[model samples]
Target: MSELKQTFNSSLGKKLIMALTGLFLCVFLIVHLGGNLLLFKHDNGYSFNMYANFLTHFPPIEVIAYILYLCIIVHAIYAYILTTNNRHARPVDYAVHTKSPVSFSSKNMGLLGSILLVFIVIHMGDFWYKYKFTHSVGYKEYRTNLLTNQTTVTDFTPQTADFEHSQSFDGDTEIIRVKDLHSRIVASFSIWWYVLIYVISMVALSFHLVHGFQSAFHTFGWVHRKYKPIYEFIGTWLFAVIIPLGFAAMPIVYFIQSLNK
Candidate 1:
């Protein structure tokens, strides 16, 4: 107990914790983005709704979700503690502030993180809470028979009772789908301001990742002469630029499509 407390109280331990949690979050982003990209599938909401259903229902995934939530809380709390400690350590600032070699994102992690924290709250309230706690109005699933060129529509809700209740279908053309999450996404993105907020938040996320990815490695003492440049490139280009661009594309594409409709 004493050793554990000592490690946690030390500066190095706090940084190591942050690094591990940050990397975990980076992994979570990739998984989340992959799931969200299902929104692009042309098949009405069948694919997306089913995917959502799987996520909510699967036990292992649910466990992971809980872990993810805990990680977020721990990460945020530690961040605040570390920032406070740093501030207390340097009560007197330099009379003249000079620009350092550190990137802006590195210097302003707290600001960027605060913005993301707001975004997460809004995002979870809008989607996660609605999907998990509230009753969705249900959605329609369309099935078309290639042989007869006949189309059939089925409606069902995402509530626990309704989701458990099964419907019987005799014809091959009949396909039952639950609430259309894709439509919900489209509806949300249709609002210009919502899209703007999403875009701006994504930009902040990009900047955060640019610094965080490399910083995590630095914290782990992996900053070698030969590998440092490679890590920087991966952090700056792949994680920072490519990943966020992919995420930004979802909102932009959906918003544009909503405009045409």
Candidate 2:
């Protein structure tokens, strides 16, 4: 216990924790982006709601969700602690301001991370809390004709008194789907202000990832003369550019679709 405390109190230990948490979040981004892409199915939210249902109902996934929540909290808190420590250690300004070899994103990680944290809270409150804690406003029932193979969706609203009983299925023939969430997402994105917020937040996320991905490798002592450039390229293209752009695309696409309607 004493040794563990000593390590955690040291600079390297805090960095290792950040690296591990950052890598875990990177994996989460891939999974989350894949799920978000389901919004483009044009199925009136059946696919997306079903995906959301599976995430919340699956026992293993629920456990993982708890861990993911913990990781987010710990990562943010440690980041604040480390930033404060660094600032305290350098209280005195240099005699002359000099250009830093580190990139701008690298120097502004704390600010970028703070922005991302705010975005996460808004995101979770908008979706996760509504879906998990409160009853869905209603669901859509998708019915198919057996002979013609034609499909139709009907909107449903459960009795307020029986809201707790609302589910994704109504009976043997009716396939009740959660439409409330899909409607919420679409409506939220339709508003110009909301879409603007999303776009700006994703830009901040891109900057954060640009520095964080490569910094994680440095924290792990994995950076080498031969592999440094390769790491930088991967970090720039995959994490910094591709991932954020993928996320940013979702809101933009949906907002455009909403405009068309």
Candidate 3:
């Protein structure tokens, strides 16, 4: 137990934790982005609302959600500790500045991470926390005719104050009622300032992932000469470009649509 504690207390151990948590978060991003893509469906948010319902209500997914939250906290705490230690070791900058081999993203990770942290707090508070704990979000009732595959949406009010989601059948029509999280999302994305902040956070995410993704592989000794190119390619394109672009597009597209209204 003492040895385990010592290992985790060491710098190398901290890096290992960061790598594992970082990679977990990378995987989470892909899953999250895929779910968010449902927003593009022109089904009046029926698909996206169902997706959100499953994520929040499914037992296994809820468990994974908690783990994901823990990973974020652990990753951030270790990053802060490591960055502070590195800075304290140097104490002061050298009189003669020289270009370093480290990448720009690598050097500015602390700043990038700080920006992302603030974004996360705002995002979770605005969406996740409210959805889970508060009655601020209204409800949506989707009545679908089984034969015609047609769905009609209406503003829903639960029969009771403590009501959750429900699905039932009235003859051939399926009635589904869930919290209108999609409506909340639409309203938030319609705000210019909110969209601007979301875009800026995505930019920071791109820079943060550009370095962190490859760095995780290096820390794990998974970057063999033959696989180095593959790692670099995935890190640069998948994590650094596609993921951020995909997330940023959500708010940008929504905001643009709002302008047309």
lDDT (10s digit) by residue, model 1, range 39-120: 8887776668778878988999999999998888888899999999999999999899878787899999988888888888
lDDT of 1 at 23: 89
lDDT tens readout by residue for model 3, 104-145: 899998999999999999999999999899989889999999
Most accurate candidate by TM-score: 3
Steric clash pairs (candidate 2): none
Clashing pairs in 1: none
Per-model TM-score, in order, reads 0.90, 0.90, 0.97
How well does candidate 2 score on lDDT at residue 14? 94
lDDT of 2 by residue, 201-256 (tens): 99998899888988999999997889999988988898888888988887888899
Better of 2 and 3 by lDDT: 3
Supply every candidate's count of residue pairs whose N, Cα or C atoms clash at under 3 angstroms: 0, 0, 0
Off by over 4 Å in 3: none
Against the true structure, candidate 2 reaches a TM-score of: 0.90
